[model samples]
Target: MPQATKLSAPTAAPTPALPVRGQTDHLRLIAEMTREFTASHDYQTIAHSALERITRYIGAEAASLFLLTDNGETLACSACYGPVDITGLRISAKTGVVGRAVQTREGSMVRDVSEDADFGASVDAKTGFTTRSLLVAPLNIGQDCLGAIEIINRVDGDGLFEADDLVLLETLARAAALAINNYRLTEQIVQQERERHELELAAEIQRDLLPQPSSREFPIHGINIPARSVSGDFFDIMTLPDGRIWFNVGDVSGKGMNAALLMAKTSSLFRCLAKSAEHPGQLLNAINSELCETNSRGMFVTMVGGLFDPATGRLTLTNAGHEPPLHFDLRTERFTPIPADGPPLGIMPGIAGSDGYAVTEIDLAGGMLYVFTDGLTEATTFGGGMLGIDGARALIRDHAEESPDIRLKSISGAVKLPGQSLRDDLTLLVVEDMMTARAASMPPPRLEAMSTDGEILRLRVPARPDRLKLIRAAVEQAAKYCEATEAWTFDLTMAVDEACQNIIRHAYGNRPDAGDIVVDFIRRGDCMEVHLMDFAEPVDPSKVKSRDLSEVRPGGLGVHLIKSVCDEAQFVPPPPGIGNLFKLTKRLPSKLQ
Candidate 1:
């Protein structure tokens, strides 16, 4: 291998100084080139124009700008200016004078190509252009060398390159290197911005595809939280025309756009086919066959789909390599896990066998069924440990007494720490057997004396803060009907309002879907008895106590407010189908009695 002679500034041959007019022209040309580089972001156009001006200024026959490829193993001619066009020519970084300049990060001037053992004659032979002398300057920005600029065969002054030419080329190479680097950086930034926008749009579309939150009394409910702008996990709930509810939870194999796309497809397929498909197993088979046709990346989806008949408290489920759904029995407080029975979708058509994925029939029997992606079990808990299956069961057991919507939120929120990202896409779906819960529980007993009093007013509303106003109106009207004074009516209304607030905050955990509240007002001669009822868990009379007035606080005031205005304020025997019954009796004025 032949090595070219490197030229250092201190040892370069000296040349005669240019005249004043010539010096002015050179300065003007360099200024113009710098302005062009700064104004335009196109690398090739600017490089070619600069090469033409450089070749003419140096009185060279041909000039070519070489840039290192991505791998840095070879130099390719990015632009050229001369009679012969060698724009796409490539050569090894160690084989020619131009390569030597870049590798050494210095300039090189060869007076005669034949005398230099480092000269590669293959380019001259291929293009039929004879090269005698050449000047090469490396394109450098600080200590980094990009490539080199090679000027071949000087057309003036005995056809030999001078030292002045090498100096000028090096100065020009710096400007060109800066321009190329800037263009690359700008291009990269634009590409990233575009990708970010697309991801956000995809995320919005995914959200629109999901079902809205159902009412608290509905038997099926679900929640989804993505780790990134998009998620690979998805869940869908669709109610068929025949009253059968179709629900599913799925996990795509990877993350980002590819996984998000697959999630969308699978969710769409379930929604479309589950409406008409008779069984969960056969519906999954159809989706699997459709996905196999276009899944070129070898990706797959693990899903569990089920059809629930609310009338029978029966669920027919089909699992395809997904996490086993946990069935929590409200009566026994036991968990039963139903594991997958087939491979994941998109692996191959009919991989679930001729009958499709195996179906598992479950009798919810007043219990709750939970379907979730691995994101839940793999999440990091506040205790700095992975929430494995045991942790997941604990979350479920803790919140099992709450409404379906609040239960799902509490379970998912337990692992979602503040100021931290999720490990994966989290999705959870719940199916409750409303029939069993209704049949097993009994209605509250009513007080005989108040029940007989003609039923002055009755109102039932959801247990929400917004519904408290309506209850207050009913209380005022009932107090007015009994001919109670303005002061008495105001006190009764305020007392009832505080009672409802306590039910929303304590019994329902402030959850929007926390069942309903029933109020009954009766006129008992000179006294008005108002009964407030809720269907939440039974409250212990010992635990329900008014706080002492000595210590002032924001809360614990509702109970005190209720007791202060009423003659009797206590939990009474509720009517049929009620959980907690609160009774308040206020005496009428002396004239009415």
Candidate 2:
């Protein structure tokens, strides 16, 4: 049965005024209690003091304060001056004199309790006290009957209980109820602390368990985000030697600690393979073999891995049922996708190998690449409608010409609403081209195999902090060089700004004290791609893995803007801090800046 609320009726009546000598003293006492005790924040302490004070102030032999619990069915004695055991006694708000007054919202007084039908003398019987004049009244505030207050056996000169006495007791009851209510609120606050603490602990553990970033003067990057207190999505970056970079992003099928732990193992193993210099397909095979043996929960991970050559700006990648990444052509100012095949990790590890992997190839021919988990596209609005793939792609196109910060703000701002909660996680990545990046003395490994419309300008630059500006200037210049119209130049300029800033901020993270970054720009026959190679720190894109940005913030704003501004962005981590490549590709003849 649903519990009844305390009387939701008229407000408590003020005590009736009467002509009496001690009335002034009684009023003063009541006022003092209200100002000093009831006004204090602690309610229970004041309640006890109020009853003890009423006993002495009113010249009553005994005083009792009954409080109604939230359910209102029981009125328990909260404080009693005459007898301590009265604290445990319960009164029914339905039948007892106190109950009837509280339920009916009335006040009753029995000058001689034994002669009054409403008076119950059992309390006096238990205490060996004679029946005497008394006052019982409901303690009400607003519409709630908090309980009742009673004064028994007036002393120090009293001819029966006068009307003035009833007035005084009523004043005391009002103050008492307010105090009691505050005490109940405090109790609720104390309980919430425990739950909040646990959530904090869980959130901390989830963050701590993620992969430790690899700080190397190489090319590779990562991102991650937890869906809840713990995350099911993660990524890792490890740079090997010989211009080879290794990185992977993956998401567990479920959420929470178990998925987080599973993500930890996958990330660790994937990063550990940095020593092997394995190709994308080979690495997935090895990891799948391990997961096939250990993934007892039957859960799987949608994963993607890649090996990037900073010198060549070539990314050899393998995808495990993850999203099909975008490939943008700077020359044509058009976009498409580079798809990979294989099941999610742990879904029969050997499945892809038995069937042969479906590999999609694209030339980072001065262009961009983008990869993401379902979280980004699957994020829902407050109205329960998902942003979906079309929304994510449309955002990219709409702001493809805006500044990175503006683009980030636009995408985030598009979803802002009060009091709405995100239903899932969203994670996305963009790899931009850093124009004027040129490095000499490289082997010609089939440049013709790559296709570009003609906006690409590939260069290889030495690793130096001062040279970063040169790369940025070169990109700005390249934008002017390739654009058929001035409008297209501004669009490319924003892409250049975002890509260079990311290479400086995300890749180097403002660590000028460390070392400088290397840059390369590849202008294909069809489109232009800018490549920024750094040997700073590589973040696992998985860190920004799965978060529901649809409703609220689960991560930072940079990557979101990168996705919105550039046609494509891809991260490639090379070995020995050798290659940390940031590729940004913009389709030529694009929208105005």
Candidate 3:
């Protein structure tokens, strides 16, 4: 057996396999290069670092990155690794595996590359090294193929390149693709932000062009404070023929610019239709329908429209879900608030409550009629309580005598002194005195059929524009005593204080519960006579001027003042069909010389 062992051909020791344990650490270090490259804003730093990492990780004898030109067919080396020269390695994408990988969108391998027919000889001739192996990967992102990465002549002994070596080189290609992608995305974001800034600036300019609220004035006041940069509260008053004051007050739901836009539109519509000779009910209905057609945003307006009738001391009103109005009767010191009868505007279409709305007839007497947006009452009190309609009415009662300008200022001061923001737009409008309205269209009074019958005490009270408080107190006192005040004069002209109280006591024989009285005015040959008819027992004319003047008392003194100053005082009693009535007379005061 020993002799049979033939000497085999001497075999070379197998090439020692390279140690690859620390290779993972080298990979992490290489991965970090891409992270740093992408993080950098400067192109030079990114290019320099990417080249250094490639040369170290692959142990390349010489390596260089050629950045593709816009045409993708040609590339100029950007970062280089080698001792030969600092100038870049230049290449055309069509010449080598670098070109083939870019064109095919895949990796390429070369072993014994000089033997391959398609391999180029120029890079080999310049570097003066026989290329043993080569690895190449396209550095493409999506359809954009950006040249390729190539490593040549590995430092370690090798046959065909190891599978892991090809993998590591391909991984490096992906990082390069991502870095290029990041730069393009950042540029796009910057462009978009600039456009957004331009739009915001334009919006600011439009906000400034609209009118600021504190600038207008008129017979009927307007207030349009805003809850935000803009709001929905709006009020407008326009004068019409024959001493009629046409006015509109409303509040729209919601806030800010949309609300402001709608308010502007509604106010403009009112002004355009201000001259429409329609009844207030009809007018409001028309406005509601128009707004409903255009108010597609589901917003509504609570409004109050008024047509002032000065001659009749009446105001015809139509309500649209607004708060009830506070009416102060100057003749009785009493308040009668007209309530809501219609829904908020723009709720339904042509069918609206404003059409079926009954006109509220009110007498402003000597006191002003204060109409306001709910914002005033709905405001927060300093105590963190809500100031409701009662609070607003009380404030009006306190300032009923002040002029509209002064009263409005008072309201502003009271709210602001407590450091409160008027959260909603608060507004107030006033009609100072309703009496001086043109009364010329009124027909002359026809005197009651002369009863040449009994004694009748008549009193004629003129419109007391200045004596609101006095007039109200007297009317209330007479009501408590159950006496009716009439409209006749003891004199040819008015003697309000004397005649009113006098007729209240004398006509009904000072009966506290007397019913209503009628005053008839008759003018014959410059002598105007007032007649009052009643069903109470007939009065004695001889005793009509006599009253017990013994002691000063609060009760009977009103009659004494009446007879002393008035031209005639007659008390009518006990007529078959008529109830108690009073006759009063007055002469116009002459101008002093």
> Top TM-score: which candidate number?
1
Candidate 1 per-residue lDDT, tens place, 1-593, comes to 01122111212222322323266777887888878877886767888888888887777777899989867789999999776778989999877898899889998999899999899999877776778899999989888878899998776568788888888888778777777777778889988999999999999999998899999878899999999989999998888887889999999999999999999999998988887788999899999999999986889999999999887778999999999999986533579999889999999999988778888999886577999999999999999999999999999888865777888999999999977889999999999887424543424423223343546777778899888888887787777677678888999999999988888888777888978887778677678877777888777768878888898777788888999999999885432235777888888777734
Candidate number that wins on TM-score, 2 or 3: 2
lDDT of each: 0.83, 0.62, 0.59
Residue-level lDDT tens digits of model 2 in 261-324 = 7777887778776567457787788888888888877888888777666666667778888987
252-301 per-residue lDDT for model 3 (tens digits): 88866666667777777776676884666777777777888889778888
How many pairs in model 2 have backbone atoms within 3 A of each other, for residues 3 or more apart or on separate chains, i.e. clashes?
Answer: 86
Runs of candidate 2 with Cα error greater than 4 angstroms are 1-21, 37-39, 85-90, 112-134, 153-163, 178-388, 397-427, 431-443, 447-593
Pairs clashing within candidate 1: 443-576, 443-577, 444-574, 444-575, 445-574
User: In what order do the candidates fall by TM-score, top score first?
Assistant: 1, 2, 3
The list of candidate 3 runs beyond 4 A from truth reads 1-219, 353-357, 437-593
Tell me the lDDT of model 1 at 309: 87
